[model samples]
Target: MSFSNFLSGLKEKTNELKDEVLKFKNKNFLHAATAGSALIAMADGSIDSAEKQKMLKLIENNDALKVFKTSDVISSFTEFLNNFDFDKDVGESKACEALNRIKDNNVEARTVMRLILAIAASDGVFDQDEKIVAIKIAKELGLNPADFEL
Candidate 1:
């Protein structure tokens, strides 16, 4: 490809990503989604490197989250992760509340739950602790545990 054509393609891809980001009507949805995923990552206690990568990968591929900037997602996840690390009681309470915001939107809530579960299983082992966290997140989102095979 010519230099100009390459630049054009790059610009087009950039615009597409920008449009996707703009398509996100509620930015809080991004925050809530990130927080929800972070909760699951910490469910098994400290998020191992592999688990962390899985969480990021899930967020990157989630249809509901793809509209967001990767950095934004990482920042939101960090905030929640740190909060939970600092104080499990207070942090979990806050994260759950944030997730509750999407309770009225079943589609969005389900998407978040699926993403969380995917992240939990990303390390190749969905342990008991991860399942517990997934259940809690499902409940917070007003979803039935049975729906997610919890």
Candidate 2:
């Protein structure tokens, strides 16, 4: 192939790789937000409508969540919310994995924590249980709780 054609092909491949990386990152953020919301919801044994609304709003406003359709995003979130079982360590594991991905991206880590804090305080009061779990998740993700002002 000619040099110009090879360069064009290389640029096309690079663009394709960049697009794929972006998609992967966006999915990672969505999963983290979903799992974090679930953790907050289960903190008090039942997730109230207020907390649910707050979380939904956060997801809606997040650019990463835009990659998913409204229904798809909500479904993922609701599944996590319903399946969250603090009694089992599985929920924590899933949430922590998501959190780690968020933290690895730096900016998303702070954004995710801010969303968590908003949900935790949505009832006008942050419960002890929520605070404890949020702190634990933050620690596991190697995030500073101070960043979220928790």
Candidate 3:
């Protein structure tokens, strides 16, 4: 009921949100990496060796996701990639879950989508399959695929 008490509570809530955003950023980066790699791999029926190597390097070098074992990240990405073969929709759903985790952080979803778009285009030509998946992911994250411009 007191003004001072309300201000204190507001500060506490803000701090809590900041902490949650930090955690969400980490999770979002991981998911974006996973989704990006999957799109590249599924681009041409098979993921090229060069693309695989790049994906692995990206995951290994990202400091925020360092908490995840190299093997764990690779395994998770691979699982999603495999799912892309049997069911593209399922693969997109998995990627959406990763993006959704950070949606509460407001801008984190868009940031993650930007990362995904960059990776999708890293191979020079954006593969059609990957582009489709990226658009699906962007929409799922409440982002505009038009922003990525394929």
Choose the strongest candidate by lDDT. 1
Pairs in steric clash, model 2: none
- What overall lDDT, based on C-alpha atoms, would model 2 receive against the true structure? 0.77
Residue-level lDDT of model 1, residues 5-56, one tens digit each, is 9999999999988786665675667777878888888887778888778777
Please list the C-alpha lDDT of all candidates, in the order they appear: 0.84, 0.77, 0.69
| Per-model TM against the reference | 0.81, 0.76, 0.64
Candidate 3 ranges beyond 4 A from true positions: 1-29
lDDT score at residue 52, model 2, on the 0-100 scale: 82
RMSD of 3: 7.7
Position 146, candidate 2: lDDT: 76
Q: Candidate 1: how many backbone clashes?
A: 0
TM-score of 3: 0.64
Better of 1 and 2 by TM-score: 1
- lDDT by residue (1-150, candidate 2, tens digit) is 999999999999999898777766688787788788888777877888898888888788877666566776687787675456434467667677777776777677767777788888888988789988888767755788776666
Pick by lDDT: 2 or 3, better one: 2
